[model samples]
Target chain A: MFGRKGKKGNYAYTVARVKAKKSQLMGDDAYQKMLMMSLPEISRFISETGYSKEITSMTGKFTGINLIEHATYANMASVFTSILDSATGELKDTLAADLERWDIWNLKIILRGKSFGIDLDSIREDLVPAGVLDAEDLEKLMSLDVDDDIIANYGRMTGVSIPQSVVAEYKAQGNLAPIEDFLDKHHFERLLATIDSRSRPTRLYQEFIRKIIDTINLETILKLKLEGIHGEPVMKYIISGGKDIDKKLATQLANAETIAEAENDLAQLDMYEFIKDALGKDTHSLKDIVAGLRRYKMKEASTFSHLYPLSIIPIIDYMLHKENEVNNIRIVARGIDAGLDKEIIKGLLVI
Target chain B: MAADLGMIMIGAGIAVGLTGLGAGLAEKDVGAAAVGAITEDVGLFGKAMVLMVLPETIVIFGLVIAILGVFVLPNM
Candidate 1:
C-alpha cells in the first residue's frame, strides 16, 4: 500500500509481506530446539515452520539436509522473483540493476568452477537462481568451454570500467579475480550511485551500505594479515568507498601487535563502529563473525524500512533479510550432515 | 474591526496542531520497528526503548511552536 506516487504497489507490498515472514525466522531458542532433532525431524520442523509448503510438495523426492537445502534455495528465489515482479517506478529499475550483482556473483562462481573443472551441476546449485539474468542466459554462459565472461559481464552489468582492464588479465592469468573485482567495484558504486539526497529516508540507507563496504574491506585486510600478504598487494585489492580502510591505513593496522589491536584501531574511525559491534576482540569465530556481519547488513536494511516506510528501502531490506534466513537454514542443514553439535552450529548462525 | 485577526489566529492554531499529527505519523513507524526488534530479543529492551522514543523530538519541535503560538504570539 506504501510507495512513491504513480508507482505500482506490488513491489512495495511484496517487500512488506516478505519482511513479516522474515520476522518469523528462527531465533536462538528455535535453533536450540532444532539441535535436539534428527535430520528427518529437522525436515519436519521446517515443514511445520516456514518451508512447509515447499517441503510437502517436494516430499518423497528429497530427504534430510538435502531436502531443506534445495527447498530453501527454491523458496528464496521465489520470494526474490516476486519482489522483482512487483517493481513499478525508478525504484523498480534500481532494485533490478542492483540485483544484477548476484549474476556477477553467479558468473564468478561458474568461471571459478570451470578453472577448477568442478561439475556444472554442482556450480549451478550454488547460484541464487534469481535476479535480472535469466536461467537460459546463465545455462548458455555456463556451457561455454572457454571461461565465462565472468569479468566483462560485471563491467557491462554494473557500468564500471574494470571489465576491459581485466579482460587481458583473465586471458593471461585465467584467474577469477578480474571479474570478481569488477563485481566488487560495481556493488560499491551502485550503492553510492544516485543516492536519494532529498529524502531523509535515504540517509540511513547510505550509512548502512557504508558499513557493509567497510566491513568487507576489514575482512579482506584481516584475511591478508593471516595470509601474510603484505601492504602493496593487499592494498591493490582494497575496494574503494569504504569509510577509510585503504592501503596506508591498513598497513598501519597490519603493523599492530595483534588483530585485536588492529580492529581497535579501526573502531576508532567514526564510520567503522559497526565492525566493532559485529565482531569483538578475537572472541568470535571467523565463520560466525562473517555470517553475523552478513546478517547485520540485511537487518540494518530491515531496520531502515521499519523506520522510514516510504521509498524502496523496505524492499531492499526484505531482499537481504530473506536471503540471510535462507543461508542460515542451509548452514543448519549442512552442519547437521557433518554431525556437528546443535549448539555449535547454532552459535555460528547470525540469528 | 480586528475580528479578521481572530480568524487568522484560528487558522494558525489548526496548522500548528497538524504538527503534532505529523509527529505522530512519524512515530508510528519508529515505535513499530523498535518493538519488532525487542520482540526478537528481550535484551534489546533498553536500546529499542531509546530508539523508539528518539523520534519524540518531532513532538518537542511541535510543542515549541505550540507554546510560542499561545503565550508569545498572543502577546505580540
Candidate 2:
C-alpha cells in the first residue's frame, strides 16, 4: 500500500482541505447560543452560517424541526459527497469505506421502516446520501416490495454479504436486531478486509474501527446487563474485531454479575484510564456513559489527526465533527419543537 | 589539480541540489495545508505564508555551504 503510486496520492491537498473544513464546523459557542433559540430562531441561526444555502432552499418545503433536520441532513450529505468526490486513489477508497457507515445507517432505517410499514417517503427523508450508493440505488432499494428483494438489492449495491440466516432470524424474531447485527458485522469484516495493517494510514483507520467495535461491545454489554440479560447470550450481540475487548474479555464482561462488575472488567482494558470517571460515576446513566465514550473517541480522533496530519485520520476527524454538529443541531431543533427545557437540550448535545 | 576542483564542484552541486529537493518536499505539505487554512480564513494568510517559507531555510543553508565550497573554501 506504501508503494510509489500510493505515496504520490494527494495527501497534502486533501488533508489541507479537510482541515479548513474542520475549522468551519460549529463551535461550542454556536451550540450554546443555539440551545436558547426556538425552532425558527434556530433555523435562522443556521441560515446565517455555513448551512445558509441548504436552510434557505429547504425552508419552502419543510418548516420547524423538520426543516432544520432535513436541511442539516441535506447539507451533511452534500458536504460529505463533495469530500468523497474530491478524494482519489487509496484515500478515496479509505474514505468511501469510512462513509459506508451512512449506507448501513440508511439500510437500517429502511429495514425498520419496512418492518413497521412506515411510508417510503418518510424513510427517504431520513436517508443521508453520503456513501458509495447514489440516489438512484437508494430509490430502487426503497421501492422494492419484499424482504428478499430489499436484501438482494442491498447486497448488490453495497457488496456486503447478507447471509440468509440473518433473514431467517429476523423472520422468527420479528425484530430488526438480527439483521442490524449482521450488517454491522459485515461492515466491519469488509472494512478490515480492505485495510492493510502495514500501511500507516490504513493502520490508523483499522485502529479507529477496532475502537468503534470495542465501544459498541461495551455499550451492548452494559445495556444487556441493565436489561437483566447475561451469560453467553449477550456475547452473540458483541461484534468482533475490537482492539481492547477481545472475545475472551467480551465474554467475561458479558458474564459479569452486575454493571459495576462489567465496568471493572472494562477498566482492565486500555481505555480504562480515559473512561474511568465516566464508568466510575454512580449517577451516570447509560445514555451519559455512551455519549461519554463517543466524546472520548472523538477526542482520540482529534489527537490522531494532529499526530498524522496527512493521514486519513484528519478527514475522519472532520467528518465526525461534522456529524456531531449535525446531530447537535437536530437535538436542539427537535428539543425546542417538543418544548423541552433549554438546559435539558443543552445537556443532550455532545459539542 | 583540475580534477580535484571538478570533484569539489560536483560535491557542492549535490549538496545544494539534494537539500533544495528536500526543502521542496517538506514545503509541499506545509504549503498545501497553509493554502487550505487560508481558504477557510483569510486572516491565516500571513501565518500560512510564514510556515510555507519555513522549509526554504534548508535550501538557503545548503546554498551557503555550496558558496563556501566554491568561492571561499577553495581559496583557503
Candidate 3:
C-alpha cells in the first residue's frame, strides 16, 4: 500500500458507498432497544442485523458476552479492511496510515497485558486486529515472553519503534507511560509525514489530525493534573502538531501551577468550549470527560464530512462512527450481560 | 457559399460532439457513485437513476444547439 504512483482518489464512489454504510449504522433508537433486551436477544438482534457471518463462525466455541465481543471485533475488522480495500491511491494511503493506530492500540494492549501478568488469551480478546497487523501478527507478538522482546519485534514489524531509552525506562520504572506516550506521538507524527499539504482535501485532513492531536494532548494534561503530577513530567506526554496546543502552548499549559490554571487556559480555546463546564467537576470520571471530548470531535467530523462530501473527511467520519457503533454495541451487550443498569449503559455510550 | 455551409455543419458537429463528451465526463463520476449507492441499498435504485440521468440534460442542451446551428442558422 506504499509508494503508489498515482495520487488520485476515488472520492465519489467511496464517499457514496461510505455514506450508505454510515446510514446503516445503528441509531439511538436501536441502542435504546438493545439496552432493554437481554444478552441473548441483543445477540440475536445484532446477528440478524449484519453480524450473522461472524456469529455463525464462532457459534459453539463462544457464547454470551464472548460471542458478542468476538463477533463485533471480527465484524469491525472486516469493515475496516473492506474500507481500506475499496479506496485507491492517496486516499488508501491516508486511511492505512490513520488505521495504523489500531496496531499501536493492539501493541499497547499486549504490553499492558504482559506487564500486568494477564494471560495471552484474555489479552487477545481486547485486540481489534483492524490495522496492518492481522491476527497472525498479533499472535506472533504475543508469543514472546519479555516485554522488551515484544517492543523490539514490534518496532521491526511496524518500523515505528520506541527508543531503547524509553524501553529501558519502561523496564526500570515498570511504567508503560513513557513507552505508550512514544507510540501515540509516533502514530500522529507518521500520519503528518505521510500527508502532503498541497491538496485542499489533504490540508483539511491535516487539520482534522491536528484537532485530534490537540484533544488527546489536552486529555493527557488533564489526566496528569488529576494524578497531581506537575512540572517537567507533564510535558513529556504531550503530543506535538496540534493546531491550538503547539509546543509553546503545551509547555505553558504543563508549567501551569494548578489543574485549575490549566483548565482556565484550556477554556480559552474554541474547541475546548464543549467540555468547559465539566472540566473539574468532582462527580465526573476522566473517562466521561474524554468521552465528551471524543463526542465533540465526532460532531466536528460529521459537520465537515457533510461540507466536503468528496473528501477524506467522509471516510474519517464513517470510520469514527463505525468504531463508536461497535463500542456502543459492545457496551450494551456487556452491560446487559453484567446486569448493569440501563441508565448506566446509556451513560457510557458516545451517541 | 458551399464553404459557409460546410463551416456551419462543422460548427454543429463540434457543438454536439464536445458537449456529448462533457456530459459523458460529468456522468462518469455521478454514475459510479450512483452505482455504489445502489449496491449498498437496492432501494436507492430509483434515486440513483434520477441522479444518473440528470447529466443527460447536458447532452440534450448540446443537441438543441446543434439543431439550431444546422437547421435554423442557415435560414436566418
Worst 10 residues of 2 chain B by lDDT: B32-41
lDDT of 2 by residue, A55-167 (tens): 88988888887788888888999989987887777878878888899999988888888888999767877889898777788899889878789888888888876888888
Q: Best candidate, lDDT-wise? A: 3
DockQ of each: 0.05, 0.56, 0.78
Off by over 4 Å in 3: A1-6
Task: Give per-residue CA lDDT, model 3, range A252-307, as digits (tens).
Answer: 88888666677767877766766765675765378777788888789889887877
Task: Flag regions of model 1 displaced more than 4 Å.
Answer: A1-4, A7-15, A56-62, A148-162, A244-251, A254-261, A269-285, B1-76
- Name every residue pair that clashes in candidate 3: none
- Quantify all predictions' global Cα lDDT against the true fold: 0.66, 0.83, 0.85
fnat, candidate 2? 0.61
Model 1 chain A lowest lDDT segment of ten: A1-10
The Cα RMSD in angstroms, rounded to one decimal, for candidate 2 relative to the true structure is 2.8
A-chain TM-score in candidate 2? 0.93
Instruction: Give each model a TM-score.
Output: 0.72, 0.90, 0.94
* Residue A270, model 1, lDDT: 46
lDDT pick, better of 1 and 2: 2
